[model samples]
Target: MTELTERIERLAIQDGTIITAYHALSFVRSSDVSEPVPAVYKPSLCVIAQGAKQVLLGPESYFYDPGSYLVASVHLPITGQVIDASPEKPYLSLQLQFEMDQILDIIQQPYFTENTGHKSHRALVIGQMSNSLHEAILRLIRLLDTPEDLPALAPYAVREILYRMLQTEQGNTIRNFALLGSRAQRIVPVIEQINREYTEPMRVDNLAKAAGMSTSSFFSCFKEVTAMTPLQYQKRLRLTEARRLLLATMSDATSVAYQVGYESATQFNREYARLFGQPPIRDVRRFLGMNPQ
Candidate 1:
C-alpha cells in the first residue's frame, strides 16, 4: 500500500468513519463491499486512497478511486456503496467539507478567474487527481499526528487543497455553483427550501417565483443539477427520512409513513417498496437482522 493509504488505514482503525481533530475532515474505512446506502451528502471533496466506491445520484452512477476525486458542490441525497474492498486492503478514503464562503474566498484571489456564464451544471462531479492536490491532502492528513500544529496549519493545508482543486478542468463547474446570481446558486436556496419543508405540499409556481425563474426554466435547471424533478426530490427525501425513523424508533410502517408526510398508507407502501425493493416492514426486519444493535 502507498504511505497515504497506510496512514489512513492506521488512523481509521475501525470499519466506519472517524471524525478527526480537524472537524471538516473525516476518514472512512470499510473492509468489504457494501450495499447501496442512502444519505444526504454535504458539500465536500472525497478522495480514496485504496479501493473504489460508487455514488448514485438519481439514475447516474459516479465511480472514483485513488486516481480521481469526487466533489459534491451542494447537499444531495445519494446512494453510496463501497464497490472494491477486502480485509487485506480495505476501502480507505477521506472527505473534506467546505462552505461556499471558502470557495468565494478563493475565487477573489487574483490568480483565480471567475466564470461569467450562468449555465447550470451537475452538483456532483469527478475530476482527475493531480500530484499537487494529492500532496496537499497528504499534508492535511499528516496534521493529525501534530495536534498543536493543526490548530494553525490545518487551514492553510486545506486552502491549498481547494486551490489545487480549482485549477482542475472541472473547477469552472465548481466555481459556477458558488458564483453570485448564477442559476446554480439561485437553485441552491430552492433546494434548501425543499429540504426544510419537504413534507409540505409543493407548488411549482411558488418555487419558480422564489427562484426568480419561469416554470420551465426552473424545472430544467433544477433537474440539470439534481437529476430529478422537484417532486421526485421531495419524495426521495421523505422516504429516506421514513427509513431512518423506522430503524431508529419503535414506529411501525404506517406510523412512520404519516410522520414523513405521506397522506395515504397504501401510497407510501407502494413508493417505499419501489425505492427499497421490499415492503417497509420486511426491509426493516432484514436490515435489523443483518445489523443488530
Candidate 2:
C-alpha cells in the first residue's frame, strides 16, 4: 500500500503529459465523492488502492475496490464515476493502457501461452490484483525516482509488467484478444469503426459489411462482446459526449443536443433526463455548480 503511494508520487515528476507516467497510464490524487464527470475508458486497466468505483459497461455494471483491477481489452464506450472518494482518503487509482500490437508480442512468446476457453467472451473484465502484478507496478513507479534510468528502463519495466499480467490466473482473460482471428479479435474492427464514426448515423448493413460478417452474425457478435446492440452503444457514446460538451463549454441544451446528433431538442432533453436523471441544463448546472434559473 505504502509502496503504491511512493511509486505514484515518484513517477509523477518525470511524466510531462497530463498523464503522469506512460501513454496508457493515469493517477488519482485521492478524493472523496468526486463530482460526477462524463468520459469513456479505452483499452486500459483501472486499479484502485483505497475506495471503489462503478463502471457502466452498457447495461451491465462493474465495481472494483482495493486489491482489484478492471481491464478493458478493447475501447468500449462507458460511463464512470468515482462514486467513492474523499480528501481524508481519496480513492487512489492507477490506469494502465493496453494495445493490440504489444499484447500480440506477449502472446507470441513461447514461454507465455494462453487458453481461450476461460477467457472472457466480453471485452471488459475485473480481476483481483495479485502481489506479483502489484509489485511489478510498484517497481515501474519506483523508476520515477531515478530520472536517467526512466528513458532506458521504463520500457523494459512496462513489458515485464505485461508479462506478469500474462502469468496471472485470469491472465488468459485478457490475452485472448491479442491472438488473431478469435471471435473477440473479430469484434475489434467493428468497435473501431463505431468509435470513429460515432457521431454519424449508422447503417447496419454497412457496419456489418465493414465487420465482414452477415448482419445476423454481426448483431450476435457485437451484442455478445458489448452486451448491447450497436445503436445502443452509439446512444451511450452520444449522451456521454453531450454531457461533456455541456459541462466543459457550458453549451446550451439545444446546441448540445444537435452537436451530439439528436434530431430534435425536445427528444434530446427527454432522453437526457431519462439517462442522467435530469434535463441537460439541470444536470450540467448541478455538475458545474452554476446557478439554475
Candidate 3:
C-alpha cells in the first residue's frame, strides 16, 4: 500500500451508512471485494488506492483500480462489482461528493477555466490516474487520522482536492454538471423521469420526446449521459429491484419478476443470470448469504 493510503485507512470506521466526516470524508475497506453492491452514485469523485472495482451504468461498464480514478457528474443508479480483491489485498477507496455550489464558486473566480464548449462525455468516467491526483487523495484521507486537525483544516483540504479535479481531464465533466445549457443540463430531467418510472413499461420514443429532441438526438444524448442506451438503463433498474425483492421478502422468481414489470419469468431469469452471474433463485440465495441479517 502507498504511505498515504495506509494513513487514511487507519482512521475510517464502517458505520453502514455513508460515513459523513467533518468535511464529507469516508474510507472504504473490505476483506475481499467480491461482488457488486446496489447503490446510487451521486455526482462525486471516487478515488481508489488499492484493489479494483467495476461499475455498470446500464449495459456499459467501468473499472478503476490503482491505475484509474472515477468521476460521476450526475446521479446514476448503478451496479458496481469489485472485480479484484483478496484477503491480504482488500479493496480500499476514498470518495468525496461534489456540490454544484462549489463548482459555481470556482467558475466565478478569475483563474477558473475550461474548453468545454460544445463538448460532451459520459456522466461517469474511469481515466488513467495521475500521481499528482493520487497524492492529493492521500492527503485528503490523511486528515482524518488527525481528528483535531480535521476541524480546522479539513475544509481547505477538501477544496484543494476539488480544485485539482476541476483542472484535470475531469474539468469539463465537472463544469457541465454545474453550468446551465451544458449537455448535462439538457439530460437531467430525462434521467429523473427514468428513475421515477423505472417500474413501468417505458417507451424510448416518449423519453426521447421528454428530453426535447428527435428520437435520434435523444438516443445520442441519453447514451452520452448514461453509459448505456435507454432500454439498457431500465433493464438494470428492473433486475436490480427484482433481486432486492427476492432477498427482502419470500418471493419466487415469477412474483419477483412481475413486481419489477417483467412480462415473462423465463426472460427475467435469463437476464438476471446474465447480469448477476446466476439465475434468480441461486443468485438471491447467494445474495442472502453475503448480506444475511
Instruction: Name model 2 segments beyond 4 Å from true.
Output: 9-18, 115-117
> Candidate 3: lDDT of 232?
83
Please name the candidate that would achieve the greatest TM-score relative to the true structure: 1
Q: Kindly list the per-residue Cα lDDT of model 2 for residues 37-82, writing each as its tens digit.
A: 4467788777776678888787788888877888888878777768
Of 1 and 3, the candidate ahead on TM-score is 1
By the lDDT metric, which is better: model 1 or model 2? 1
Model 1 clash count equals 0
- In Å, residue 7's CA in model 2 sits off its true spot by 3.7
Model 2 residue 41 CA deviation (Å) reads: 0.6
Instruction: Supply the global lDDT for candidate 2.
Output: 0.77
Segments in model 3 whose C-alpha atoms lie over 4 Å from true places: 12-24, 36-39, 58-61, 115-120, 130-139, 142-156, 249-251, 261-267, 289-293
Clashing pairs in 2: 24-97, 30-90, 31-85, 31-86, 31-90, 32-85, 32-86, 33-85
Cα error, candidate 3, residue 172 (Å): 2.0
Instruction: Please give the ranking of all candidate structures by lDDT, highest first, separated by commas.
Output: 1, 2, 3
* Total clashing pairs for each candidate: 0, 8, 0
lDDT of each: 0.90, 0.77, 0.74
Error of 1 at 29 (Å): 1.0
